[model samples]
Target: MSTPMGRNVIALEWLQFGLGRLVAAAAEEGLTIHLLTGERSEYAHELAELDSPHLVVHDVNTHDVAKVITTIRAIGDVAGLLNTTDTWSLVSLEVRAQLGLAGPDPACIRLVRNKALLRRRLYEHGLSRADGSPLADTDDAADVAARVGLPLIVKDSAGTGSEHVWLARTPDELTAALDEARRVALRGHLIAEPYFLGPLYSVETLTWEGRTRVLGVSSRILSAPPVFREEALAFPVALPPAVAADAEQWIEQVLKCVEYTEGFAHTEFILTDDGFEVVEINPRLGGGLVGEEISQTLDINLYATFLDLVLRRRPALMDAPLTPSRGAAHARLYAPRTGIFVGCQGQELLSGHPGGPVLRPALPAGTAVRTIAHQDGCVAVLFATGATSELALQNVLSAAGEIHVRMEGDDRG
Candidate 1:
């Protein structure tokens, strides 16, 4: 393998909502982005449509490590390897390690990718209160229930978007949840843990060379269980000074425990009566326009900061004001029922709304809408800004209420 030093950063996948910002930032920094994605990914066409001189899309099987490495070598002069999505973090890390680039440690990526291992590490470090066990089959559900107790959550050890996650209120429910989880287990193992009831908050942090900085704390709106589908997010949410400090302290400890050296980390936790209990840690930026919301609230461009981190440069904006100049929120719109989508109504009202909420549909018209199960069921996302949190949230709600998806089927309630 020949190493060619080029002004190229290889992104393992490009389907993330924030890829455009990354590409734009890279272009501004006089860098080129070589996006490696599957041939069938919409990103291939999306990148082509951009016609950006700094952006190049390569059709390759990302799952094949050897192929990806070969492609990277063939491109040569690779300055960095990175990914902004959970599904491709490991792949990105592997490529970075193979190429001897700066990134999170491979062992750390392994620990965070496997929920069971993450729980174990946290438990050992006294960072977590809950106990969890890994289940490989339905037969293990009874033992897991006995260990973790009822009202527990059974989920794939490495699942995303709440996929194959189920809440079990009883032993029978536990078994059923295990069965459901087994069907979608990406790693053929399920993790069962006690479910804490409380509001969820995600702490977005950027770590570089082992130094961690908390970017923002965002409150999460989630769909009702047996599935923890995230519905919306409001950023720059106020937290008691002590609570915020403690959450950041915990996040820093987690990064240290996992030996995460660099990159953005999105850590989710429940604000319970006792204290903050960790839910999970995603080694990437928060999804669902979180970076955009943060940018609106704090005047920080996280996508640009991510590029600076990859280049091993200190992000100048890190010292910028952390206080929110304006409140920002993102609300997800889901299809009311399964049907063929015709179009969205009340879009004109949103265009003229006072709060300047931006409405973006996930799927275009003439798309099929299936049962609302996970985040994939979301039809659109409404982004709004206001002088206060209540106003921002209200703006999103008002716009979302007016915009309705016109579907063809009448069977769904």
Candidate 2:
């Protein structure tokens, strides 16, 4: 692996707050970062802190594809390319391939992009524990549901962040789930699988070549099942060593099957009585600074490592010592109910809490927010780190209790 003289890497279509932190971190490492988003305002302020000499911005939505390509070309030489969003993940692969730059293979990224393709590929490689199939339409979807039996899980074929997922317990529930699946299919296709019930767990890791190393594991707590809405994540998973070992083995097999060559992967799984079943695989850093927080706890710069992988350089990762902190937990805060922008009370109380690890006071006083469907609004996110995963969970829950959300309109529910 060759090392570049300077840090002039590019990040594609940065939008999320995580990307901002990553940009800041990269700049701190003396890396000049470039970004492309639908608009300049989306991430300009975030990039301002870096004051990088090679910051490039392109309007992804309005810019011509050829122009975007030219824009990426104009960024001079890039040591590495990072993408925060899945769409950009694909684009980054293309750009890397065009430049003969190193990153995950674009073809492999395709399999990861579509859940149906991922399941089929994994099954072909004998990496799947549960029998799963892709739903082409309402009929095939229903048939798959019937075969998988009731109490099955239906989700988008290429979905993210638990967009359109659900659990169907009976024929009627299955119909509703199928309908929802079809609706989501209108946006894209759907992937229907047996609802594997077990302690929900996720493996966050960085893979180089074919060697997939387990960075950390988290026993995930979800508000609902099959749908898999992420509620909380507790790291340094409290699982028997053998159980975690098996899960790691499954992850390795899946990565090999999908040909995941570089960078970070957030894989969700279930520890069933028989074995672990893979829920899904995302070929990027996990959301909400999961990699950062976990890296902090373990004293590894996962973000930097990811950059190294993309840059076709060997980070001194093998020699790097892991200092595992006591397990920690991360919880998300959503509005109590759905409504227009009113505001939040007890903001100071929540931030000034004595015994909590608040990553940031994200939600301002009057940020207009809406729920995923108007049932509940995601007003704020609180990540609490503690000595133990259990203690961390308790502190986040307690802090969530401390904050008060103010909303307008009558009770819709």
lDDT of each: 0.78, 0.66
What ranges in model 1 sit over 4 Å off?
Answer: 1-5, 39-49, 138-141, 185-188, 408-413
Q: Write the residue-wise lDDT of candidate 1 on 1-413 in tens digits.
A: 23334589888885436667777888888889888888433443244346678888888999898999999999987777778787887878777878888766778877888998898888888888877888755356668877888788877888887777789998888777766666653743677878988999999887777888898788888887776887878877778798788888878888898898877788899989988778888888888878888777877566787667667677666666677888888888888778786767888887778679887666666778776788777777888988876678778877888887777764367
Candidate 2, which segments miss by more than 4 Å at Cα? 4-7, 39-59, 62-64, 138-142, 184-187, 225-227, 351-355, 359-370, 373-377, 408-413
Instruction: Quickly count the clashes in candidate 1.
Output: 3
Top TM-score model: 1
Cα lDDT tens digits for candidate 2, 287-357: 65476467657766556665566557765563466556866666666655554546555657765563365
Model 2 root mean square deviation, Cα atoms: 3.5
- For all predicted structures, in order, the TM-scores are 0.91, 0.86
Candidate 2 minimal-lDDT segment of 10 residues: 370-379
**Top lDDT prediction, candidate number:** 1
